[model samples]
Target: MRDEYYGRLLVQRYQLLEIAGKGSMGQVYQAKDTLLGGVIVAVNFLSRSKMNQRVRDRFMREATISALLGEKSIHIVKVRDYGVDEEEMPFYVMEYLKGDSLKEAMQNQPMPLPKFFSFMRQICLGLQCAHDGIEIDGNVTQVVHRDIKPSNIIIIKDATLGELVKVLDFGIALLKSDESPTGFMGTPAYCSPEQMDGKALDNRADIYSLGIMMFQMLTAELPLKPKTSSFDGWFQSHHYQKPKLFSEVRAKLDLPQALMDIVNRCMAKTAEQRPNSVTEVLKVLEQIEQNSAPLTTQSQSYTANTPPTVEAICLQSIWPKDKPRAEIVFPQLIQYRETEIATMWIMLSRSDIEKYRNNKPHSQFLFVGSPHPMLLWLTTLYQDEQQHRMLPCYLDLKKPIGEKILQILNQTGSYRLILFALEGDERCVCTIEGKVPTRKMQLLKEWLLESQNTGANHGQIKESKRSLKEELDTLKPKLVASLQRQISKKH
Candidate 1:
């Protein structure tokens, strides 16, 4: 059967070129659509005689769903034609994509932040279209792509969008009225808790899968570690255990706090806790992109005012001497783009510095800082309760008085070591590294206070805090510029 289809044209129209891929359900062939100006298309054929009634039904449904969903979204792979051959085997033709699957790309390394966000937004849009329902026979029927994972996501180059995201493989998709007696399907690692439990699923399940994918793209690792390769192992992990926090796992990686929160919510154990629909997820992502645009721009043009030094920010004497029990935590490098001057520096607001002094655990801060305008804009966007927390720290390029603040940062694991200098009125906010900056800093300060109370001189501890406070106070107003510009002359 393979040989017969490989050489001969199906229905005397599609000229079979070569086998593109083969799967458990069917085979896909690279074919020339003679009837369509000889355009290259992918023809997926399901050998009817070789399959049971169930498999055949699933295959036909796949073709129909692909066709329906494709019409609703450009992100979904487009289906052009569907028919049965003279031999009674079913085949469907789709627009041939000339790119690798997301699975293949991740094998090299995780995608950069800009590319990852862009691809994810498109994926959500495609899924939202499906979730919104498709019109058929004057009735709308909702569809859920039960299988959403890296392998099912294809990256194609488009003339306009650049990197286009195409979601494939709707073979296991569930229709609103579908009553198929299918058991559990979908990759275990990426499956939601509801999906694993064989409970009725919805758009939220797909949201869970997306969260898992986002975690992988950001850190190249899964949130939940499976104990065994069996389905039960994964099921137990997804249902019973709490996945490690993204910040906890990738402590050194600088990521936006809001973005991580969204990802975490998407993977919630219960569907009720997850985003109500793909639309909600899309809205949140869009807001993040809009709010982060200014800071992203600043990071791209980040430059330090001093000489570029290869030396890691020194942490040895930065901490207070009396704070013997306090441990220093230094920021780890996420990505470095070299320029004449450093392009990024960590910035902290007055409130943020105060939080560190107070040392509250479980307080997660974004590595990227929010520009003043962005902060003001975000406040108006979210509720009053959420306004303050949504603001991010930006990089301050002004020179530090000495190594004292550097020591405090190292001990608290609060800031990255990017040097920055304010040349003019340009105000910049940047991301800092650390899981619990406030707690760490508080511990260090506590240790310092204790030492002074015992035998150490109280004058030094008070002077250090006073000096740091003065420096921060002096820099606060200057960092409020709405516009950030690169200095014309290099320092």
Candidate 2:
């Protein structure tokens, strides 16, 4: 990403290519997927020398989390994939935001309070998405945009205007949570008290930041005195001691008291004492607007409390099924994660432990292949993470190889054994010592083919579930209205 900051291609894979951009987190690269053809993406990478081990890990982990977020088809930037460059520099791909950040717009195209509030409201909606959102994990991964300043927010001039108001820097910005060693949350001026101090912060911190942004957008000056806090030798103070009110900032503007209160309370001293929730703040803003003259484009289409589509298959769907699995002793595959390897090793270990646990013994898998890169990694990972028996079988599933597998399973009477052949077909027919799993093997082959041709079965199921949920969401209100009408007639 260094040399090819904007236009040039720094790294090239089969389909992926990288180009860079100027951003808060240094240069960003636009990666193109040549295989997909015309599908271009932006890749955010932590530059080379500056990235230490933890930063690199977090950078990679952030992409994993983003991918797992699985909020597909939403307007926010989409994270695609995470991998290392030839130089071993970590990078991940995301949907490129076409327009410049809000900072650019603030300078280039200023808007009136009504229009600006509408845009910022869309951001607040995005923030609320983080607040009450469900993810691919099926659990709540509450996303607090730790850095919600103008530069990170973008109003895209797009084919779809409704999708215009988007919160950029969806990942890796406000990542400075109590979970990490680095407590300093985000940019000094915009960061809230709890965020600055590394407290167990949540959505309220973003609300505080939103208040600060609103103040700046209207007043053209930060609510708190210009900081240079990093220059002020470390910690900066929250405007706890009677900071001037929004009305005070521009007396003529005299933002409605209700609006002023919302802002003041958002920038409250204690997060607990802040507005009950972001939804509450939105209501308060609406009330303020109602009492005062109408703002330019008051949106009633999507409000903050608008219910969300909570899918069941996401990460939070079921706790990991990692309760001790069957243990069978088998050679491991490399390039696999610990969990993936554990599944194979544990099954093998279980086979060894429960050799006669049941009359109908479980299957033994004959793993035959000219080790593909993925297979190799999975083998290595199984050894490293699973810490199973050191011996791992690495053989091609050729004619004689098929005979060898037949010999082992037949000798052990482990005909129930499962076979995982890379070729998985006539490349190595079931010329075993005894009977072969023609039907079961065919089924297995079909499944493996499905996974390769389509994708993870779980991912496909998730997509279907997501689609069903969207349809249900569209009907929920109408159904409620119909029920109400019926009840009225009965009454």
Candidate 3:
């Protein structure tokens, strides 16, 4: 028998070409956008037979969440448009991607260390974007992807960024603000202990799942195998059994200790024991990639090579005296190949430094209101003179976390801000010293209000960063002049 909807057109725009795939909630079809001159797209429709209020809500939420997150990060799959068809069945179109699923690729063999680093970093970036939360009903609510596995991640070949990863299927993702649903939901092998028990969850639960996936990616076997492929079996295994060590799984697998440590921490039985945030994971991965050598089997150990570590540019001598407990931000000149370039640097205080200890950092974006739309997000650990890793987060200004950060800044009373000209012959062409006086604390409060009131246009974040660059460009000359005056007084 022929498929009924194979040749049908949806919304009079999408011409369904073929059935690409099917899932519990709906079927995905390879469709062409007739309105866009036959551009290929993926259209997912909610099964009409299962069209109840609960299922419909989940389907629509998935589309909305995907659309919002895709706008914020390229690692997420993009949803182009969504609506109902003539049959009143809800459907959404997504950018059709040509790639292999991570699950399929894994079947061939584990990825090389460099490829694994790139792929895992991209996946974490997507996960972090979701965890950062999105604005819904005037509040920022984090998203927990209840189902995170290899099959959901698509790896595409990119000419520029090498391999680009796109995380798919938010059908079962739980919004932090949503009420807990009953029963187990997720692949048993990758489910966290809390997930297996159907308990209240957070970002750490996802970290648990990621740990299992990481292990499988390397060893090609699960760390904890249940006696049976049933709910109770996985439940017992997740709650009672301990994960096998990397060496136990593959004795000859020559891997970095740091990498093994990360996997172990991620797969911790309890959520509290796992890394708090994906940014924390990214920071560790960054360090490992820069410092560790590629893994090789015993037979191939002769070809193993260790990558050179990035040299730390210490500024302890020039650090401000008054703001001993405050963070210092500077623009440093770095020698990259043949040219000297400017990159951001950060020196953190003991308190600010603690945030990154367990992969929990107080990183959040502070936006500036109209006249110019700009936002500032602090980077806690600065690893180099070049190549800064930007982990963006839009923290609610009214929340305790946001308040705590601001209070710390106020209590510290001041912070050091250094300026540099990357094109200059000298590294520190001039050092301008300044502080946010106690009298200006009120001014800081006003600025915070402005940022809270600023409309967060997700698509324009990069543009806002450009606006900030222009503002910095305007402020640099004045700081340079101030430095000149201080030098004259010394003479």
Candidate 4:
């Protein structure tokens, strides 16, 4: 896709320098955010044509994942903003670094042992970020970077230091414990066997890729080179073949025993046999780093011993002979707006009644909303009501707004009634049906009329719910008409 301009009327940050790189869904450009006053930034833009549901989900999800990773030691590209231009093209702003691929770094000059180990340590830090980001909804979703080849590993050149590693390509990575994941996603060469088979995968898949990368970084050669050109054939080799030892690439590059031993554990065929986690990998790497001693030619024997901790629980999925699932299978819930809200209210009603039956009356709920009187009303109601509870929802969900409201209600069913105050024309009352209590409805109608000083309060009986209202004075007859039709239809 061709390059574009600002998202809104206001001039944005980062002046466009030129296109730096492009992934399947977006183009990464070297830009200067003019508003930020010429600080360099990487601008990733996804053309509208490329934005199918999956691509859009992946694009936005990048920002969500990045926000969780604010570590200075981690090699993650920081996300500045994700938005659309007037033409509706999706773009994300990111921190830019001048660097070549690790493949280039490896090829350019033999890295000093200290620098080499440092790069490896940095990679683990970035992976750890993905494996443990607190989500937009206040839930932690473990990120697994399934692709970890040299190409995706950028070596940022600094004026002072030689290079710093920044691990990229989190867009296609899986978030753990998600329900009903769509399908397998990642580069084939670097993909874990489970990832290749469309089986469920978790953090271990990333460890496997890290293993392959470590192998390349140390030995300077891939464990397996498929004779056939097809990617499927190349992937099949991972399942069938024993990886060539780092010794095979020793001619090209020599790594110390401590580092070599750690790389061996990462290249294990089975995910369980691999380093149990990025954390474990870091431990081994530290061992390599702290050891100022040396290893001889015979000391190069690398054993497969990954320590077991809570991380072993994640690796347990690999024990069975069969390949595992490629991603999570979350609980399925229906996807309607008002119907979802009603379902939530129904659950809340049941829970509150249960609470009343059991005799516990006091509770507090922190209602969150952007500052508005309506939000203030909801929070005040939360505090004022006793023996029954009502609170506005704060959690961010993957679903739409109305659907999320229902989810919160369903999840926290003890609410006597969750209050929602509408702003502008996005009305929910007309859409809700027989599930609404008439008492609440009447109270709400009067409340609306008093707030606006009009509508059904005039008392006429002729109608149906409307999407738009030119005047509140016009609603009473419509309300009466709607109720009569409902009663007559029921009879």
TM-score of 1: 0.59
For model 4, residues 39-121, the per-residue Cα lDDT tens digits are 57777878567778868888888766764573322367667677876667777877787878888888844466766676887
Error of 2 at 49 (Å): 2.1
lDDT of every model, 2 decimals: 0.60, 0.48, 0.66, 0.53
Alpha-carbon RMSD, each predicted model: 22.2, 21.9, 12.9, 20.2
lDDT of 1 by residue, 1-491 (tens): 25566766888789998888864368889998776557688999886555777778888888888888885566788787888888788888888888988888777455677678678877887898888888777889888887888888899764323467889988788887776525687889999987887777888989999999888888888889878978989999999888788777777777778888999998899998998988787767755654554432333322333321222222101222222221112222221121011111223444443343232122221111111100000100111222222222221211111122323443544433322222212232222332334665564445334332333222234344444445545643343321111111221
| TM-score of every candidate | 0.59, 0.54, 0.62, 0.56
Error of 1 at 36 (Å): 2.4
Candidate 3 residues lying further than 4 Å off, grouped into runs, are: 293-491
How many residue-pair clashes does candidate 3 contain? 0
- Model 2, residue 89: displacement in angstroms? 1.6
Summarize candidate 3's per-residue lDDT along 1-491 as a digit string, tens digits.
Answer: 22788778888899998888764479989998887568788999998788899899889999999988986666898888999988789999988878999998888466678668768877898899899998998999999997889999999765323466889998888899978655678888899998988888888888998899888888888899889988889889999999998888788888889899999999988888899998888777766765664322211222114322112211212322222233344333222121222233344333433333233122322445544344354432222223122333233333223333344344554332222222322122221222345665565567666765654344445565666556645654554454445545756
> How would you order the candidates by lDDT, starting with the best?
3, 1, 4, 2
Q: For model 3, name the residue pairs that clash.
A: none
Model 2 poorest ten-residue lDDT run: 310-319
Off by over 4 Å in 2: 1-26, 68-75, 108-111, 133-138, 170-181, 226-234, 239-241, 290-491
Error of 2 at 368 (Å): 40
